[model samples]
Target chain A: MSAAPRSASRADPSPVPVIELRGAAFGYGEHAVVTDVTLPVHRGEIVAVLGPNGSGKSTLMKGILGLNEHLAGTVRLFGEPADELRDRARVGYVPQRHTLSSSIRSTAEEIVATGRLPRLGWLGRPKATDRQVVARALELVGLSDRAATEVATLSGGQQRRVLIARALAGQPDVLVMDEPTAGVDVASQHVLADVLARLVARGVTMLIVTHELGALERLLTRIVVVDGGRVTFDGPPRRFAARRRARDHAHDTHRHDSELAAGDTAAVVPHGPADRSGQAHA
Target chain B: MLEILTTDFMQRALIAALLVGLVAPMVGIFLVQRRLSLIGDGMGHVALAGVAIGLVTGLEPVLTALAGAVLAAVAIELLRARGRTNADVALGVIFYGGIAAGVVIISKAPEGTPANLVSYLFGSILTTRTSDVWVFLVLALVIMGTLWVLWPRLFAVANDEEYARAVGLPVLPLNIVLAVLTATTVVVAMRVVGLLLISALMIVPNAAGQLLARSFTSGLRWAVAIGLVSAVGGVFVSYPLDTPSGGTIVVLAVLIYIVTAVSMAVVGRLRQRRHEVAESHEHEHGPECGHEAIPHGDHVDYLHDGHRHAAHQGHYDEHGADEYGALSRDDGPTGQDEEVST
Candidate 1:
């Protein structure tokens, strides 16, 4: 879910690192989901996490939220262990999939206002300011006009945006999204990306778990690659591409040798500088 | 109707109905969201078993039934929390075990105990006691208050538990609280609606509410409204017809649900046809509606990710021509992450 914990480096510093994962290892019973990984996200950074299906990317995301008690390692938010991190008020999350109650019958604005729960204190109602924030979130997600629309009648994309708006209503310091672009269309993807980019520009630290990195690369500050529950690469987007190339080459060579034994030329290709660097790194 | 409210027993029944109205549907929202509609059935049966046990022991039947219901609720919660299998499957197993256990417990009791058990099963709303009314009020207040405080957290966790936790909401306790509240409501409402009819009170209003309401809160409010109306209205109709109040209430609720369902279906069909007509017109012309149909948001761009590389290289070859990839771009934000056609 996170990268190796780094102490506040003087090279770059903000008020504080919003999230830190140190040697984090997460798993379901008897299955290690994510292992021996650390990730640090500070304000104003857009990080994309990439991994194959079953590669434990979602588990790492969950681990940071303390949803799955990772078997080994620690997760910290705002300098406290995740479990003790009470600044939930500063964290917002949009899920990969949402299973809403069938009985749910709220409007989009009302749904967005719910994001203020953590910030509203016990027994607190939404204040005038809270309503303004909700409106802002709706506007950010381009749902203000549909604020009064029935949530159930919304298209899937609108619902997803509503979820994002709900998260944004929290005015979180860190917005964590699990595959925020999973089931939307290309234009909506741009809208969502632009919105998220704008959020990043506003200094909201974002940790996004997504396989759809082509378009997302334009918005990210860094990229993290995970495979078999471990951090294989954590740096810029190019580093991820380089890592992907290495893994692919190793896999391709295995296929090549098998194909050669069968005298198949179709699988063979000349190596290039990019391939060599990836191979060297591997 | 006004005269009925003047009678002490009638007042008790009204109070009980009002209390059950709020509690049942409030908890029903959670059950419906989880798709465990039969949980009410399972818990209702368990409470009936408790009532049978109480009748044999000559204890206050309602109290004993409540205690049994609370224990059953805890068991259900524990099994569900383990998360090894589907919650519905776990509920089925627990409820069946409960029924069997109740049968054995009831059989061991003295003769004539079955009559008391029958009342628990069928309910005797007209006979609701003053003490029962007070208990129902207290329980309803507690449940409603808990919902008021936990509404947002509950909504968040219900949408996605893992996501809620990541955002730092206490999800586990809230779930347990919901289950406990359901247990209490099951016991409290049993006397007014009976075990057999209690779930009707829960599901009917929610079903109707779901048809017309716009949001979760609106659905709840509508469900509560329907329930109160049916409860009071049932009493009115039952008195003139000389019928059992529980049966009357259940029947009336079903009637209301049917009316709401039919109207919603008609309205929904009309809306869909209109939308399709508008869409076809746009296709023939160009963006006449002016509101461009937004494809689902959150569409992933598959080309840039390693998945595309895998697809091109024949890695995970089985996924080549996989519909998931096609769906991915379809789901991406419009015009952003389209895959280059091979």
Candidate 2:
């Protein structure tokens, strides 16, 4: 069964975007990293945001997650203003793997149980339903056997899965991940891809910020490429590949013929995967 | 030891020590985990200023110290939130400022002020009044109750602050509450370990517990146990040795930390050797032994230095290398390339 769009109905008529950003700019403090970007993520859609380092892809995701407030324009979650959305449990966030410090000595079960914090009461006691949800999340990530294991003792791949399980336990309608596969092993990446596929099949909307598409290439319904703090391209993966190749060719000829000004060099050098895969695609 | 416990003064001191011991480490465990161990020191300095204020005004030093500490805690949190400086820098500013202010305030006070200041600074557990014991008891209950109610939120914030914020955990209020708790712990512990050594009481036992513990709950239990033993044992030893009570307690706690750290290293080495032996045996046995016998070397490496090992392992992994390549290729003009590796 396909995942139903949350809160979408005939009376509403339109499928409310799970995440909506119009001319949004986001950054830390006074410095804006992602600017003038308009993007909408519909229900059940898997969107991959690709960008170079310091290109503000993560910042954009942070804006949607409300970790970083939008400096400009409007950001809406489930048809509500981003900052005003009270139902945070509906949007689960899986940050980069290293975000969890090594000093944290929690078991996988304990970590997954934390995802239930929003659903829990002030005392933060996990009810039977919470426990069952946490268990199911661990099972979904194929980590039920390792549920009691200390996260510190788990492999990098296993730790990543635990993080995914933590987000899943929230039962969020939308999953936002920042560089899910970065620094992960190839085998683990494949495992993550399978997990993402299952999540998609379950109708969970995903907005992922990543450098390399790799195994995630197949699961993506749309790809958004950011360059120099702006959304340069947003379309289907196939069209992205086609457009990227054409852009790379034009960039190559421009680089070879032009006097190579600093501005020219910066513009031609597609940050992140675009630069590395430029030749491969050509 | 039994004879020493007979006197009313000794009994009061021991009770205070035990009470501070139980609550201090409970608070300290969270502080250490959050890398805010020095917050105890900062609050201790502020407590000194409070003590000076009490001396000059003829008020109860403990109550004044508690008030001073709470105010200082709020100020530190405010400064940190305002981004006037980084956390450590802000803490350092308040830490030294409080001590300096206390010194200046004490200098202008009555004749006995300096002596009282010294006692507070170094701690005089033998001189701990019955009223002080009651105050410590009340503070312990309040602090422990607060921690009990806020355990999950505090743990989430301490473990991964960004994740806590993303999950809509009230990170700011939780942080302020933690700061206030740290202040309370420091103020209460100051009677046993002194303002100067309060952080030792707040850090050493928790540090030792972290080394020995494999889980959060176990770490907390171990910390409280270690702290209690150190407090009572230090007082017991101090009476016989004729040493300072606060210094003795801090020394014992430090000794526990050192011993635990060294033992962890020794144990890690032995485990590494065992893993090496197992790996060699697997190599000799060939493909039938399976990849399970291959031994995840990173696990052993992590025990040595988890942060560095994790970073290195991330770099050494196949995907990390690919990302590194992609990163290096993108290092075009900004000269900010090394960031991607980290």
Candidate 3:
């Protein structure tokens, strides 16, 4: 409850980045998987963290989300230390959709409703406003009619949207999604990009981790390429295209990259300046 | 029929059974949803060691069991939270270790034979003392009160732990809380359901509930209802049949689970066959029809608009839509529909 009130003057784009990391090193044990990473994600900026199969991109995202141990430097959220920041509601998170176990008995709406838990706290039951927010989230994802449908019965694309709606339901200041377009059909991938475009239009800040950035290429305001452990390139989509071939990002036979390749990587339109550059990563 | 229930021991058994029935499934459903159904079973074994401790020390076995189980639960949960040891490995170590230790510890006690531990192993709810009933009542109140306040949070964690952690719910504490509640439940129901059979009471009724459960909330309610019937009914059944209550209760729950499973499968098949019957109206029997449904049995029936047409054979059979309409309204589409929609 002592969580600092977030900056109300969002119209001016607050000087402090919503999420800031300074020379951070994160890993499970003593060994650092990702090291010496300095990155700042501002409000309303859609930063896509791109990498090859085992480039520690996911590790960096997890470190930002406070899932992994911060072995080295500073990691801050809403301009506060990671451990001291109590208001986790300000950050809506959508993990990899596959992490959700199969055969969940919850409805699409019910799964989304859980996103409201951080706001409601222990004693507060879900009120009408909470229900309305959940409905709005489902509608935003075009699953309003599927509000009562069981999650298990939904298709993979539909389930992914459900996970998106779940993250959106919290009305977080920044949404951190891990591979939002992974493991879905080509049509679904485009639909997800459109959904993301809408979310961006609403000025929602995001930090997405994905191997295939071409699907979300149009909406990406900035690209942060993490090859090996550290940041190799951090610039706009256009700059990333020009600065391509600086390093050999060999994407081995990882499960994620292969799925998108086999499953409609072509249907996702390559951007204006980075068709070949994008295909290199793909 | 009611006179047998009026006896003092019967009243205690019924009351205790009702309480266990009410409480077991509340905790069990989350474990079942998380696929940690066997955690309770492992805790039961740990509680056995606690019971052995109590027997040796001349203290109440239930209290000792509660202490042992809670400590083991917290310890095991801590190990899991550390991200080093998996729950599977912890369960293996503690599950076997607890029982082996109990067997050894009980042998050293003066009044403890392997025979003395029999009641502890299988339960002795009929011979439950008044004080023991009061103790269980208090424990039940504690568990229910905690769950009443935290069931939603507990549910969110069980539904998806990563999401729960992201949402800033104290995932570790809540997990530890669930583990502690599980240990307490092991002690509370152990006298009635027995340590060996108690986890079945926690799981079987919920398994039956999931067959027809519409959602988690509904599933939980169904589980509690099924658990209540199995617990109280098993008590009554055991009285007349001269059988063990714990065994009878677990058996009854398993029977209900089988019945529910068989019925659900039957309903699903009936829905598909009935859908085939419903399809004959718009469906024409030809290669152009492109109708391939349920590659089971000899043929598929197209039941639509009061006529059943045999698929691919250009044969039409008349049927009553009235009789089949009830089947059409069956819960929702079967698993077969998932293929068509996706």
Candidate 4:
């Protein structure tokens, strides 16, 4: 039976969150990767989880994917425990670009067909309609022509797009991508941005982990900042920007004070070295 | 060829080869994709021990072998998962233990049963009974049918486990299916190729298949083709040359792999050279000619291109924050916006 429009409305409208994690903590063995984190992801929103390497962004994503053991707190996806949401035909995941080893010689379309695998019968051959869906997914990612191309031959960015196509093939309620634009060229980045923009327009819920602030800044509705395994900030992009500006200004003042304390000798000493190097070069 | 086909044992061996060729390679697709080719070897060794135990105990060898292999496979999985040990390590432990137990069980008897030993270790296709052939055929059919149903799930798991799980595929059951199919293949193969050479049967076909084909499905077809050829071909070779059927089949499979590997290498090189020539021609036309556009289509093109342009490029920038000074930070509005449609 089709879910009623009224039911969708009553469940959670716009600002109402679909995923809520409260004081979440997770770790590998003894070392904690995420701790005391609280964040909410809403439907039809692109929330970028930003942090440095090993800063718990991936850990957070893993928690949402229900891969990691939650040491503390709760993660609810679509108002259900992340693990308990078995009808995750609603969820699409494109893992980190390198998660798949390219030594495997599958075609782009074949890889995309994997997205429909969970929905297939026990002997999971793709039916005629499933093949059509795979084609549609490849076309959506602008990879229709490369459907027969081996994944090992695709450029990094195209592979990323192929991975997205694989996720999109499922026609999920939520799409989670980790660092899609990483190691890709600017043109590929632009193409991927265009694709994400199109998906966003179509109301696909997206959680993208990216470092391309300029590109993601234009796409994301909310910025969830994590530091030391905690949600340091979860708000609008503008608010995040404002907070950073304030923090930077304070940091700049602090640096300036330290520079002033070091006195005028530093600038003169560096200038002499630069002038001598320039003259010697000339 | 007609005379060979006329004999019941030859026909049985040929049919057995066809079935083993199909099932082994089908399952090998997943095993090869997962870089667990040696698991096939480990399971085969375990199967040998099972056959030995069956001979010593006087039980039906095929059934006992299947059960032992399934147990060993599950044991291997459990040990590896629980201990976080490398699969090879777990396999090593089980492989040796299984054989030692089998040897101890076999040595308990004073009078040696060389017929049983020959059948289990080296394989005697001439001794294969019609009843056993029927049993092999049935088991192979059932395993293949089950594998056919679980293809997508198995492929997903082989490609990436967490991604499959995230999309709600029952990864655990699918893993069990893979192990069980492997066990079934070992059992079917035991009647012709014997236990010691079963891994070769599973792996060589796939190795040969991957070299000759492009897609995983194509690889499967090619594996079966090569396997069937080697099986029937090996039987023919053995009959004329007075050699062991199992050894002959394995050798033929290896030879096929070698030839395929050499040919694939040559073709790959030629293709690379052609692409280079094309790339150079495109480059001669200059940047405006869209020489830059082609690199984005290849997987490793970024590593070759990005070093000259972007500093700290493609690294995950957390929360679109302060690390990337060149990019503007713009986190727009918060929460559900009507910008996204249902």
State which candidate has the highest lDDT. Answer: 3
Worst 10 residues of 3 chain A by lDDT: A1-10
Off by over 4 Å in 3: A1-13, A242-282, B86-90, B108-115, B276-342
Each model's C-alpha lDDT? 0.71, 0.77, 0.78, 0.72
What does the lDDT come to for candidate 1?
0.71
Candidate 2 residue-wise lDDT at A167:
88
Over B1-342, each residue of candidate 2 has an lDDT whose tens digit, in order, gives 588988888898898899888988888877776877778888899888888788788788788889999999998877876766477677787888888988888777777644466678877766688898899989989999999888877887788888878878787888899999989988887777799998888788888888877778888899999999999889888888988789999899999899889999999899656532111110111111111112234231111111111212123211112222335444332322222221
Q: Of models 1 and 3, which has the larger lDDT?
A: 3
Worst 10 residues of 4 chain A by lDDT: A1-10
Candidate 2 scores a C-alpha RMSD against the true structure in Å of: 11.7
Residue A8 in candidate 1, Cα distance off native in Å: 15
lDDT digits (tens) for residues B28-118 of candidate 3: 9888877888889889999999988888888888799999999989988888887774666866898889989998999888753333677
For residue A102, give model 4's deviation from the true position in Å. Answer: 3.6
lDDT (tens digit, per residue) of candidate 4 on B16-85:
7777766777777788887777677677778877767777777776777888999987777666555474
Q: What class would a CAPRI assessor give candidate 3's docking?
A: incorrect
- List A-chain TM-scores for all predictions: 0.80, 0.82, 0.81, 0.81
Candidate 1 regions exceeding 4 Å error are A1-11, A14-16, A238-282, B1-11, B86-94, B97-115, B270-342
Model 2 quality (TM-score): 0.81
Q: Is candidate 1 or 2 superior in TM-score?
A: 2
